[model samples]
Target: MNNLINIFFLFLTLTTSGFSQKPTGVWDAFAFGAKGDGKTMDTKTIQTAIDQCHAAGGGKVYLHNGTFLSGTIYLKSNVTLYLEAGATLLGSANVADYPITPSKYPTYGGDLVTDKMFIYAEEAHNISIAGRGTIDGRGDDFNGPYLSPSFSGRPRILHFRNCENVQVRDVTLRNSGSWVQFYQSCRNMVIDGITVDSRENKDIEKSRHADAKGRNTDGMDLVDCQVVRVSNCFITSGDDGICLKSLSPNESCRDITITNCIVSTNASGIKIGTETSGAFEDITVQNCTVFDTRVDAISIMTVDGARIERINISNISVRNVKGTAIFLRLGARNRTYRKNAKAATGILKDILIENVQGTRIGGYGCSITGIPGFLVENITLKQIRLRFDGSNKPLLSDDDTRKPVPIAPPAVNHTVPEKIDAYPRGEMFGRLPAYGFYIRHGKNISLDNIALDYADDENRSAIVADDVDTLEIIGLKAKPSPNVSEVVQLKNVRNSPNLPKSN
Candidate 1:
């Protein structure tokens, strides 16, 4: 038995073959009493196929040429769920069809987020879901407020926790009741060529923000995972298109890479942490395109006590952006990982973003801000061009993400409240004082070869720095507003060519 098991594992490890070739150990779901009619509940039938495959030391549990309606089918070790062309694994519309299974790996706010999923794998190894097919969560069946995470009954399409050697490739994922997929506390995962469309309403402008189909249907959420690569995908969603979260400080997400993707979203295009209880280290993002985003194109945030370090982002392009090109905030929302546990402000440091271009950006521009007493550190932005459309109406305290713009900069106290404990978002600070960059409460920051401009005339400075230590700016090309004297506004900034030799 041991020798047979070893042989099965070796076979799968060697052969990641394409869909055209029928794998040797393929177990067809149709043979296991799956009707594949899109109406009959094939939950038990599909589960049986998975079990048999796992019992046989693991092979492909195949579904082909039909829509297999299922609910809460669990994956196991060394098993691959393969879907052929023109096939779909559809989720049951009834909420009770998906039984609640708590995650095996404990993470921060797990209960608060979700515990229900359609295709779940826990404590499993060498698992994969591949082939040219679709997994439709039927998200319209579950309703919630737009862009808000539902604490009530909602089902994610895929949830795998405490799993290793996982892969989900070349599949179309659609219409999750909540997050499309959540890979939590898993390692050595590869998600490639998977397209996601999780939005109930893709048009943020015409609908006037009415997402009745589903709320918080993020494209994918990789939480507390390590050694992951995501590439060659297109994502459009109601919430964050591609997101990484550290839901527990004890479990960090390390060595993650995302490249060669196209994203369009009503929320942030790519983001890290508003849940943040764990560290994120050695992450890289490259060769991506973002368009028609209602919020930040690239956002890094740490509100809870997690450390984010050694992140590199480059070669990005954005068009028709209604928010900033880049946004980084270190706040003290500090919600505990578990109940009654203490939480503190997290760290956001050692980030490099370069070789980016943004056209038709909003007036809100980029904001890199840390709170008082704790500063964001060692940040650099180089070879970037951001051109705003000169129309900006930032989100209000009520979370009205899209408000009408005024003619010019408002004459009021500097932009927003501290909102120290509020949710960290790109528009959390409202319209910034500057139309290009507003950086404050930071240390050891540098900006090189930046060009900030607008199509129409503006009434704010291009760049504003306040309460920064050890700052440097080189090769900046910016035009000031008609009302301001200098292109760059400085207040309480130190160690730069802009200031005098002495205080």
Candidate 2:
């Protein structure tokens, strides 16, 4: 009996290896369960086909014009999931079918298992999932009972981790569980001409448990990644339309460009995290149209102990904002990670906002706040027109919400670097601001060609700089608003450049 068992095991191994090594294309091998005896589940056959293709050589796993019900199909290196124009790859509703495996799982807060994504691809190169058809996760199947009780369950539609040279275009990804699309630790990713739809409304609040709300999905989230360009996409989700986050203080997420997109989010139109810990620089978000968001239309925040710097925002427009039009927050609670809890917190600086217009802003026109020991500097606002709704006028507070008092700059830390001693040189774009731009305990800050339009007369100043140094402002203007007084100031200023004309 023992000998027989051993022989059977050996034969099974050989057969499995042989099948796994077979290379089959569309014509040679086909798994058509849609017509094969209604009970014929083609999952095993399709897996065998993909395994064979990978074992021999990577090629396309083609699906014809039929409904192919599949469980999380893992694509190997050099393999592609190609669908015909009329094909639809339907996902299995049984949650048990997708066994918990090591996929591209990006952890947040203290829990690593709270949010698990499907369709995960990790550590692969030159892998593509392209088609004219659809790769629907059927996210609604996992919506109730076993889902999050407070809000709703999250299901990630397509998640790619640590991948390279990935291109996703001409696809319709609807009914996602959590984030519609998420790419982490990836490089050279291009996402164009895609549509993301959700059933959740934007009236929900944003917090740690925002995912529990219905369709509380982030359209696209790129964290700690590089060389990602997202353009020409329409995203209307229950949460942020398009958000980029890098909260780990040890790493840097740089070199990302977003252009020519239409976004109508429930939260922010284009936002950097309140949990931003790492540095986000060399980012360009331009030529986008946003409408009807509950939060800021375009927001860059560094709460807690995070450091965000060198972000360029240009050529964007927003309509019907239910929150602040544009808010640059450097408050005390932005830090979601404790990596930098020891160091004196950093600043959110070198941000350029140019050619942005909005209608019916629900909150304050704009607010730039800095916590003690950290400053919000080198921020330029050029050509901005913000009109707010007349109802639900919340009292705009001037009381600094930051706890730790802000630091003061060195009185002798003059702008002119003394011959050989320059105060830690840093590269910058555009000219520095002279007067309208404020600074405190911050060195090497500048603003040029920033125009402010205060259409509301019952509000406060347009630009206020309380405690900062080495500040520069040029060409500042405040368009006539109803009851606004003294729209720009350089309060407690020191060792700064000359003020420009406030037209």
Candidate 3:
């Protein structure tokens, strides 16, 4: 009888232990706040419950069809925040309640500072926040201070840093105080089927400011991250739509891709490097649409000495660009980098733009600027058609609005007036074009099919290759009207032996 009793007790113990080891759903079990009728304002209790769930074992924490007010939620690995349809996670308004820590600011620069976010995770892995629920950051609460004349605003709505294998999908993140979403130094990250909207304010000018304006409120910012992909997302805000950034002037950003996305408003559509302290390479942006932007539709710049190279932008359609359709500038300025106790600067190279189409370019069709020898090179513009409807060329600066007018070739011989000459002088019509096709100063380049159209009835160049080498034009076409000829013309003087013609 004693042996039998002991056996029965052993069996019970084993069964209970196995049952405890199984994954428990947070709501079904009282790990955080009591699964409260799923109605009460159980903020602290719910947070406590979530912490307990993480400590015990990773599992699913849920908010099902109710309004839940919360302050900073920390998520751990092997855990997921699943929200049922119509559920809302409202953020706390008091700034002090959400304390700042060493967090990342997607743009401007990086250093730890105090900030708040709806969902935040750092240095963790294998995590996901998925469902049909809405994560609302009551941006209006945090709006006053941010909009103050002196305020620079906070970072982003949702941020994840130094994490691996992260997934954020099917969530509506709206009215963020700053950028809608930001991912910094994260790897293997995927963001899909996300919808963000912040256009309620009608003050178009103030809404576009980098500070009180949308400021750094980009739709999605991927910073110094690898193996990152953003797809099927719609973003419209007061700032850039989809942006990729790196520590300017030094580090390299690789293996990043953006596809099948719609980005509009405020500023550039898809941008890389205004703060480029780092190098950007192996980047591909394809099948996207951008319009109604105040600045360049697609702009790549490194003024503070960032070495950018190996970028591939293809199958992009842009319209109504208030600035240049494509603007690439390598500033003749110095970037400050620390050595022993001082800072220094350098140059940039290796960029490409291909398969791009634009309509109604308010500025120039394209713009490229840099210095001598250490210039921007190996850039290509292929299969591109641009129609500039405006009469005035987009100004590079307030005083420099005179559009670059290409010199025409002799009418009788159909040859460029000047022979292939040396630096600065031969490029009197413009700067020495390096390896360009239907354009100028872009070097060692090729054009499969490129068209440049002007509505101002002024002359425009079909192809401008100033100071370049090894250029090939397979199918080149241009129409510089008689009236427009004084302002623009087409001439290929690179003297390459193999210039192919499709017609």
lDDT of 2 by residue, 227-257 (tens): 8888888888766788887646765568999
* Model 2 per-residue lDDT at 44: 60
**Highest-scoring model, TM-score:** 1
Candidate 2 ranges beyond 4 A from true positions: 1-46, 103-106, 109-115, 144-153, 202-212, 304-306, 334-344, 390-459, 468-484, 493-503
Q: Alpha carbon lDDT of residue 400, candidate 1?
A: 40
For model 3 the local lDDT of residue 422 reads 16
Using lDDT, give the best candidate's number. 1
Clashes (backbone N, CA, C under 3 Å), per candidate, total 1, 24, 34
Give residue 99's error in model 1 in angstroms.
0.6
| C-alpha lDDT values of all predictions | 0.82, 0.60, 0.59
Q: Once superposed on the true structure, which residue ranges of model 1 sit more than 4 Å away at CA?
A: 1-23, 107-114, 145-151, 211-214, 391-416, 498-503
Worst 10 residues of 1 by lDDT: 391-400
lDDT of 1 by residue, 1-503 (tens): 99999999878864542222344689898877789999999999889878878977999999998999988899999999999989999999988887755554553354533355889888899999999999999888886554444345678888888899999999999988888888888999999999997876676664425645436778889999999999999999877899999777678989999999999987789899878888999999999999988778999998988899999999999997776789999998888766666675689999999999999887666889998888999999999998886633333222344344332445322655676777877666667778888888999999999999888767778888888898888899996777777778788888776553322
What are the candidates' C-alpha RMSDs? 5.9, 9.6, 8.1
